[model samples]
Target: MYQYDEYDRALVFERVAQFRDQVERFQAGELSEEEFLPLRLQNGLYMQKHAYMLRVAIPYGTLGARQMRTLARIARDYDRGYGHFTTRQNIQFNWIELEQVPDILQHLAEVDMHAIQTSGNCVRNITTEAFAGVAADELIDPRPLAEILRQWSTINPEFLFLPRKFKIAICSAREDRAAIMMHDIGLYLYRDGYGQMCLRVMVGGGLGRTPILGQMIRQGLPWQHLLSYVEAILRVYNRHGRRDNKYKARIKILVKALGIEAFAREVEQEWQHIKDGPAQLTEDEFRRVAEGFEPPAYQGQGDDELEYGSHLTMDRAFARWASRNVHPHKVPGYASAILSTKPGPSAPPGDLTAEQMEAVADWSEQFGFGEIRIAHEQNLILPDVRKRDLHALWRLACEQDLGNANIGLLTDIIACPGGDFCALANAKSIPITHAIQQRFEDLDFIHDLGELSLNISGCINACGHHHIGNIGILGVDKNGSEWYQVTLGGSQGKNSALGKVIGPSFSAEEIPRVIEQIVATYCAYRELDEPFVQTVQRVGLEPFKERVYARAPEVEPCAI
Candidate 1:
């Protein structure tokens, strides 16, 4: 929600103009595909399996209703009728024409959004908790810091071409909803014992071919040095991070090679010279950024009866939806409603049509504040909805195909646009996701199972975040045939842990059954009301592995 100043506007406008010329040169045969690859990537344009994909940054996953409407317009005019909301809380249009990318960027710029830094080996979008401002348990709002980082990193000459893509996340809540531990740089903002705000900084966490949890480089860093400290870390990595091998280019690989202690020392050495420099945040700058995110005016109706129970009593379907989709808000008589785009059996996860986007925009204005949030789990959030309007909003969302009512259930899958779109994919992830959803269509059955995150990636890139799901499925190719490898016990939270692989790979045909076996094992072995993750952690992966491999003896068994 940070408003773009004249400087920000000029920067984007200049970049758009530069890219427009580049697109012209490419079309004119002056720039070959190889020559233009980095140029296009820097602008968040990727050449996919069938067409170009344009990823637009939704900074810190916050957008106003007008911005949402603009995105809907972009989807309708430039690309396909829908967009895919990604795990990083950005949105991608998978069927964009190469020539129309500049126009798309222009449209985004009009709304103070752009495709800058959404891709490439440079620092990507700075993400944070989707519920930053509104979360009841937050120690500090992270959006101001996220915005500060975004400004500092945008087209930074020193970091424009890093060894690999860098991702940073900031979280202010106790729950760690931002997956802070899995980012290249993660910041946990909290108040110190003396009531002064500070940041806990973690560096070098990422998932790809190699997944590693970030190491804490700095603890209790005063909030004033946020930008300066980040600059120091990036400067260290940009100078020394490997470039000879793409596989070893990430800061995680460097951190792993250097060891945490050495890395922390290097960052500290770098920081000592620069901590109190100009990049050190000023009180006025902080206030300016914070002002943009000032809490919207609320009626402040204390202890008002919401009359929401009537819907639960009158309609079983509504009751089921209310149980899963609605989350408690800190404010009295208010709630955060998750409008699930991951509908089962029919629609692919995170795919939303243009009309649906517009409808959601309308609903956000009507039932909530004129604001929307894109959660990292590929769901849309109306963050400040009145509890009294839940039923009406639910009905409108259901009509718009935006209401699946499965926020944390099995069918609410996180999947990448696999072979259907991504050039790097080994298999089609969407159809397989559909297959699984169709097989487990019962809402009660799914809810009863409870909070199972099934993430599928078409390849080891882990674009779907398979490494962090409760049931992680990664597609692989064996002798030109697509197969899947499963991992379990992974979670993204305050207690974040990477999942361990259960056993051998399964054929595409066998994936559903494999999943069923895994779920069945959970059902059989779980303690009272134990979630799948808790059960797996309690008994270890041995019990589930034994049952899963027993069903398919041909596949080799492996331990986590």
Candidate 2:
């Protein structure tokens, strides 16, 4: 993980002091809510249903043991004993008191972390592949580029107040685990034919009221021009992006309105003037960032036979967890273990209790590298666990009910804290997710369903990425009643596609059955080992829709 330099520390602490003053003024009635909104938002504080919520950025979702321990401390001492990990790899404390935010920020700064750009109409957290450096299939480590972008975007005066909040994700692996297609700016780092590293820029991609897969604007762009090119895109959007209506403010909306060709032309025209400017990265700069991400010291056992295999054979439960939770590591005789946050009913998706956080911190060092990663799928990753230690790590994970073997399964749901926490949510998301999770708690049955994704957002904002889940669920408000809408055929990857609505929204009580029907339909039509998504595409939404709408009413559906 990249350690903060003096300049970085100064900036973060200085910002914290400034925010402390802002909060003081707002409390003293020196600043109105209107005047204080932007300031608080810039600091990643939001007014939720019960109290303030503080979102702390886990930049590109990388954290060391010290940082993780600090986060656990914050959760234990300040807010409730748990924090919610978001899809963006950020963590949110939902019960934050307005007065203690400064203290929280100070504590975060102490661990080289901050809440900057986690929210508001600016470049949010610069996310990348969670297993960037450790993925065996990676072309290059995307974390350095992600960190460079993070530094470039942080407090970049030109983009601080864009027309709308912008999100950027970088991916280097063949699999698009970062959901590159659903970001305001998606950069896929790859090597060209000549064997030089470059970026494939995709712009105008986002999900909300309007969902659009990013269009490829620039391909084979030299990695050195990353900052310059990003500046050009932001400049174009800032100058022409709509300001009149918040709904039409995202860069994706602007890109859609202007067509890819014209948009690319404008960005190119803008880039020509600034291509060699101060922002153009230098070889030394790349070296400096790359040094921080050098490969960890390995034991060099090279896929040797180990007790881990014996343990797997002896313990069915451990084997089950290992099969789904463990992923291949770049280094030999090592693995990347996913600690599932989705334990069903007991814990909400992407949530961790203070004790659990501390345990994970201990496990990160005890198992592999002294670092942890938060995947876009709302799971925590121990990036380089030695294969021999899988059983021990699994035992530690099982302590907090985090040993569920449901990664990428139907019960491994991606969900947002809807009406339960978010003020903007139309319905309660956690309860519904729990309801569905309880209905499908059978691990064997869930595995039988095979490689499924179900995402739920409290509103059309798509915070849960409901637009990209194999089965997307959105909470709707119909005459003050909580209704749930379902979308199918959505996925995130090379073949990313937005989900299509099946029918009218169903009530909370009816949603679990609706999902069951959809699953049954997929199981009936699937051939061989085809995944749920392939079956949906092959047979179209008609089969699922027919089974779903049989009980659905004629009411209009929520346009998620």
Best by lDDT: 2
- Give per-model TM-scores: 0.97, 0.97
Error of 2 at 459 (Å): 0.2
Mind giving the per-residue lDDT tens digits that candidate 1 earns over 1-560? 57899999999988999999999999999999999999999999998988889999888899888988998898899877888899989999988988888888888888888998889888898898778888878778889989988998999988888988999999999899999999999999999999998999999999989999888989999999998888888988998999999999999999999999998889889999999788888889999888988877777755334477666788888888889998777787788899998877667888888899999899889987789999989999999988778888889888877777788888889999888889999987998898898878777788888788999999989999999999999989889988899999999988888999988899888888778878888887788889889999999998788877784343321111
What candidate 1 gets wrong by more than 4 Å, as runs, is 302-304, 551-560
Candidate 1: C-alpha lDDT: 0.87
Best TM-score goes to which candidate? 2
Candidate 2 per-residue lDDT, tens place, 70-153, comes to 999999999889999999999999999999999999999999999998889999999997888989888899999999999999
TM-score, cand. 2 vs. native: 0.97
Error of 2 at 92 (Å): 0.1
